[model samples]
Target: MLFSLVKKDLLLAKKYLMFMTIFSFVSPLLIASRSSFSDTGFVSLLITVLLTEYILYISISSLEDKSKGAALLCTTPYKRNGVIKAKYLLILIIFMCCFILYTILTYLGISPNIQQMSITKIGTIMLVLSIFFGILIPVQVKFGYEKTKYIGFIIVFLTPFVLPNLIKWYTSSNLSINFTISLSQNIYGWIPFVLSLIIGYISMQVSIRIYSKKDL
Candidate 1:
């Protein structure tokens, strides 16, 4: 039943996936060619892949709202918990696919220094998705995407800017919060993955309860 819901989402967002695949290959070439990049463009690779999928998932909510899909789903025979689980799982699965796509391209001898997509890199990606899902889903479920649209835009605009600065600050600052995410694979690789799992789990539970109570 959960699989069916995921399939429905995939079907509805087929065009987004189609567009993502094209960028998956093309963006790497462009980023690798740019002069201002360090980490040999791997930063760009991760950001581009993540932002593309993040926007697509958020767009799905907007689409669902426009079509009254969530309101209708609430009236269906399906369990509300299943709807929440499948939605969260869908984001995880798409993130894995994008990671794998880049990994394979680099494995085939493509450069930009993506020789291997590290556990920490993938973990950080999941953390980003988890944060967005944790905030976006409950508000969206409770208020509908129409009410959440501006919040989503602000988030979308702010995230890319904020994440990099946070990374820079953590990497360079003398504060007690001394941690470099890019190098965490050695010291704290598992932290982001574990934290994201915890966060995503809690988010799912919250969404389930919110969705179940809503009169939609």
Candidate 2:
């Protein structure tokens, strides 16, 4: 049953999966077409990776809701927890595959230096996704996909402005940052990663609860 649920989402999301796989390969070349092997190419590649991964996950889940698939799933014998669990698992599988593809292209001299997509970079990307899905899934699960656009607007417009400044502040502070320093030591430099995981889990719980009580 669990496998079936996962398969269902994957089947629903195959188009997103296919598009991202192709984009992950061609994007780096497109970026490098203008800048050769410079930092701009690397930056563009990363941004493109980040954007496509975000879209891949967002569209998979959002489209299901928009298509009334979520409502249909509710009427099935499948449990709400399974629906939430399968969705998160599907995103993670796709994300890691895309990230690995990005890493491979970088190493194969196709893409610019990705520096192995270091754990910190990977975490940052995952964190952004965590926050996105964390907020999006609940809204769609409860209010339907139509309401998700408002949150989508917030992520699109606000996060770009907010995250860079937040990362800058976190990286630049000194003794005034003793508390954050403590967190860094205690969490083994995974504070954002940990927090995002927590948020995603809580959001999944919220969605399950909402979907359970929702009018199918």
Candidate 3:
């Protein structure tokens, strides 16, 4: 039953997935051809682009079902938990595919040195992105595409501006307070990505409960 749900989702999202894959490949080429392209810069750009692609994919995929009013799946022999699990499983599959593609690009000299970022930092980044993607998925499901798009835009646009200032203010006022302890010491040298993953999972579960009760 879960497999069927996942299959349905993939079928519905086939076009967007293809576009994303092509974009992932072409984006690196465009970045590499730019005047400022260094190994580090290329890799950073690739990661950023790929992250945005994955988040958008997950959000759109979740919205597809809601937009179509696919209530039949909810009435099947499968439980709502199974449906949610399938979505997460799909997310894992997407993550693995993106990771493999990124690795290949690194090996081909299209990106930076993979070893530059330690495993812990890399893991943390992946975890944080995964959690964020997870959170966005449920919101997309709950709110549908239009409202979720506004919320998503606000988050994507405002976070970059807000977080730096927040960090600067915190560090400026309390150097002796040891902000590093509160932050993740791993890959990006910041807060543990595991924290985001934990929160995201809890939020996803909450979304599942709410979606199960929804009319459609």
lDDT of each: 0.75, 0.67, 0.59
Q: Report the C-alpha lDDT of model 2 over 1-216, residue by residue, as the tens digit.
A: 877887877776787777778887776566546542334333444455556656765666677756878778777887878988887776667667767776777778854434454466567667777887787778767776666656665665454345445545655674253343534554555766887789889988898898778877
Task: For candidate 3, write residues 61-119 as lDDT tens digits.
Answer: 56665666356666677777777777776665665566566566666775443323455
Candidate 1: residue 27 lDDT (0-100): 64
| Prediction 3 global C-alpha lDDT | 0.59
How many pairs of residues collide in model 1? 0
Per-residue alpha-carbon lDDT of model 1 for 1-216, expressed as tens digits? 988998888888888888887777666656556524356444656566666666777778767878988778878898888989998888887877777777777878766455565677667767877887788888878888778778867866675566556656765786784655665446676787999999999998999898888887
> Which candidate would rank higher by lDDT, 2 or 3?
2
- Which candidate would rank higher by TM-score, 2 or 3? 2
Candidate 1 stretches with Cα past 4 Å from truth are: 35-37, 40-42, 158-188
Candidate ranking (TM-score, best to worst): 1, 2, 3
RMSD of each: 3.6, 4.5, 5.4
Q: 1 or 3, which is superior by TM-score?
A: 1
Put the candidates in lDDT order, highest first.
1, 2, 3
